[model samples]
Target: MEAHSASYLRWIVVLLLVSSCIEATSFSKVKHKNAYATMMYVGTPRDYEFYIAVRVLIKSLSALNVEADLVVIASIDVPHRWTQALEQEDGAKVVRVENLDNPYKHQNNFDRRFKLSLNKLYAWSLVDYDRVVMLDADNLFLQKTDELFQCGQFCAVFINPCVFHTGLFVLQPSMEVFKEMVHELENGKENPDGADQGFISGYFPDLLDKPMFHPAPNGTKLNGSYRLPLGYQMDASYYYLKLRWSIPCGPNSVITFPGAPWLKPWYWWSWPVLPLGLHWHEQRRQTLGYFAEMAVMLIQSAIYLGIIAMTRLVRPSLSKLCYRQSDKSINLVHNSLKLVALWCIVAAYVIPFFIIPYTVHPLLGWSLYLLGAFALCSIVINTFLLPMLPVLVLWLGIVGTLMVMAFPWYPDGVVRALAVFGYAFCYAPILWASMVKITAGLQLSLEREAFLPRLGEPWPPSSFKLY
Candidate 1:
């Protein structure tokens, strides 16, 4: 029996080995085919806008008859809600990179985040692909881009006339090349300035190449070589037109930045009336209108409460300490009072700061009339739903206010007041606390004996601590 079992086991092992070899051979062929396949990479914090961009890309690619894969590398904390949305899209794969360590881990800084994202992209070089293209989450595809595959070399990029926009680019993935790039970036070998574009450009100085630029129709400055015509990548703003409209184009034409298009300097004149020359401007406008409506609703609620109180429609009831009834009643009353207080504060202070200026800015002959119109539209739409808008807006508003206060761009006293009251109030406390902690920690460490040196030393060890 033992001899028979041993023979059977040997045969099973042999069969398993043969299966493994067959699988390996199959995988190699697949890799070879995929080598020529075009792929686009988009990284985001996993939000609705990201999914929207993915859907648009998938549809555009399908129309172009291009065989492509959509790769999304997201952090672990990305919500599962995005998973379902991405999975539902054809030719899309969402990859969650676990235990990923960001070399640049400075949180809350935009520059640091951008550097970390580039590093993450470099890390993705290990992923199976012949060529890779990186696109921002806010972008919308206009047409089929199968031609991008033909341009593959060491690296292919879309050049903007104004700046080197890293929002989109095509490159072959090489682990060795990526590692060298990372080492150069981290060690400040090639780019001491720490700019990712400078490092990439310097590394492949000899390999930079551009394709032909497709010219646009006359009277439409939107379609010229400046519009990412061919090897050239233009700012999405170049398509900006009267009343916020933009020209439509696809896989070849993409919307780089979507969420805050109104905040862009060029769009300031057109303001809220986003040009509809593009495909998704209506959706973008709807999103903006949604947020604006939220603010207006919040203001309306406050008005409702104030009027109710003035008419004595709802009386404030007092409750004394008790075992069960008072406990429940007091809790309810406390919550109610808190809600009323918050609503009043938001209505009186927060909403007015944005709304009053927005309303009067146009009528009072302030230069940005389009901005006022946009703000008004937003407020009117959101008047009933402001209370449900995400609380992040408050946090964002505070941070924005603080930046203005710290910088003090306005010369006039009124502008200064607006800056202080609007921006400073939200950000000053947290900023002050962070500064205090850093200073105190440094002082404490400096005063410590461990940080000092023994006698007869060339210099106190603490002296080097300043570095």
Candidate 2:
């Protein structure tokens, strides 16, 4: 009797194990179907700021009558409070993946969480829609974005680094593709930058069939317009630099950035006085300024270093430190070094030519011309052209000292120190400002509020239903 009872228990355990496997398999496998479009947005509920942005985004979509599903893949503990908030709009389908090890919880990194959520969502391909349009929670749809559904194969609007912005893209979610993407992401075979864009760019090389370059209808008029259509993805950094390119706009406009117009001061000048919602342009402008300033400072440092080198060569005896060489050889070396340095500086700053001129005002053409000339002269003289000019000035200052020493005195230390200081001081403010703009712009409160009642509507419908 004891042996029989033990055998029965073992059989029961085996049965239970088999049942578990079937349940797991059911979750993993998905049914396939013909083309159908659905919007997908993913985020962790723990991040309150991101949650706010997500709500606003959903509200914007609802206003445009676009049907979207928001997938909040988080830990079991993440509050269901957002569901109540989202349901108020009746414009979004909120799916909370429960009792799972949410990679996004606690960790500020988006890579791991994004991968995990994407994997799970792809697994639902059988029950979910055929095509999935992935959007970031922080994205605000300004116009009707239905055109995105018309995309064939995989479709995404174009942005730079020549990679598709993962902020918004269309894909036929499949188990095979999901598995492939997760494997690639884990192995670093995809997304060297470890961002969504990098992952998509590396994984689905032939995904985006159509390329909508601009982010807004009048994006060309906006400063630094490299965004992917107004209804697609609008990053604030593009606006900060004032590059003014093309952007698509309509009902599908998407405005995305860190700080809203109310929070950012830089964009106050350009944003509409009675702004409809949060404006993301401020953040883009801040980012552009930061990068441009860094580039400028790097070029300036090269020029200053070249200047110091030339000065030391000219007055070796007067200089605190000296290179052992004949006067003629030193002069030749100085001139060559200066020229090379100057050329390098110019090349670094000028190669990536902007379509729009960077002058403060086109009417001040002569002033702009003079400024350019001055800058050019500074570069040429300091880097390559006139090595003796600085030495001549130094010589004039130390005539008495030089006469006493009976040698050419070179103030190498002073020159080098000045060069370093000049470079740092000149570029520091620009870099700081740029950083501020980018950081501020990327902050979460920039999107419009998702829940503002029309007129006399109740806070949440008294007879609302949940599925």
Candidate 3:
């Protein structure tokens, strides 16, 4: 009887362990509150940029005093410093999750930008919230959109008329659905675009036929899937036409940047051209101030100023050479040296543009680039006595290209590309003309001097060895 009782207890223990393992595999709904959710993961080139954007987003939501919890579905690899800032500084709740394996990553045409985007499917496992509005970090909130909680089990906007945008959507968390979705992923579900957008769209292919959602007057939660109005997820492109928003429906709440990745509102250069980008910057200023990048900018500015000063103070002279007037070998060497000097000037302008921080405010970034370029170009000018017109023309050309690309009236990206191409075509001849004039001036200066010191001129006391 003792042995039989011991055996029974062992079997019971085994059953308990199996039950716990099963429970751990699927989420169980517990909390009753609603939440505003967004996901963050690493491995993207724009990780820091997105990190800043997410913080600004959460802070803006808090500033609006929304009635729902701000939740970030952060991957486990996201730095503790970032997650801590979101939790403590920004008053956001972070749910750490593993990077969701993207089964479609091996397929051709898959965008690497969306490599970790499938991590968004973890929203369904967030059973602590009765409803969650999954958001993209690029969303700029114009007003509180707490009413999104009233949306049903699945709801999204049809920004493209037929297809609903996944940038922002409402969903009710369900463990069974989450489990089934994982099962589908494991079974190699058809994800045409190889991202969450395609997978979710495929999962709910019938949402386009659903009725428009109208929340009941008494705040009763919606049950079935429905379509959200365009006002909730207004595309940022719409405001470019008139530079004003006129979306008629629910409160014009959130504006999403569904255009080019570089034109996202968080990018400082995206403003003044996109106008709406300023709104995002304003939100950032009100919440996550620019103090962090300011120090780096100040340091860079001082370094550039020092370089300019040193280059001006020490007028480093080149070695004086003797040459016959009709020597073809000397003439070839002279032409080669002139070409090298011109290339150096071009490099001076370009190298600094890439060296400056990528996401600094546009004004600061452009200012630093210009100053650094000028400093570098001054070195070439002072050393080789080359004319500055060629360098100035190149700088002006860069500014022109930016303006043409940022012009808001282009009907589509293809037209924008063509406009840029046309601008380049028009500018090339002028640039060539400047280069020719610069080379001519340089040649004239060299021939007139004939590499000979002026009468009674003393040799420099210090010289760099160039062996």
**lDDT: which candidate is best?**
3
Per residue, candidate 1 scores C-alpha lDDT tens digits across 110-177 of 34424434433442253466555666544455555544433343433444443345556555656566
Kindly indicate the candidate among 2 and 3 with the higher TM-score. 3
Decoy 1 TM-score against native? 0.44
Give TM-scores for every candidate, taking all chains together and pairing residue i with residue i. 0.44, 0.39, 0.82
Error of 3 at 200 (Å): 0.6
- Model 2 off-target regions past 4 Å? 1-46, 67-75, 88-91, 98-127, 185-190, 207-231, 240-252, 258-277, 280-467
Candidate 2, after superposition: displacement of residue 348 in Å? 44
lDDT of 3 by residue, 153-250 (tens): 99999999878999999999886787677667766799989999999999999999999988788888888999999998999888765556779877
lDDT tens readout by residue for model 2, 70-130: 3333333345665555545433444433332222333345545344343233322323454
Q: What is the lDDT of candidate 3?
A: 0.80
What are the RMSDs of all candidates, in order? 19.9, 25.7, 7.4
* Distance from true location, Cα of 394 in model 2, Å: 41
Worst 10 residues of 1 by lDDT: 315-324
Cα deviation in Å at residue 233, candidate 1?
3.0
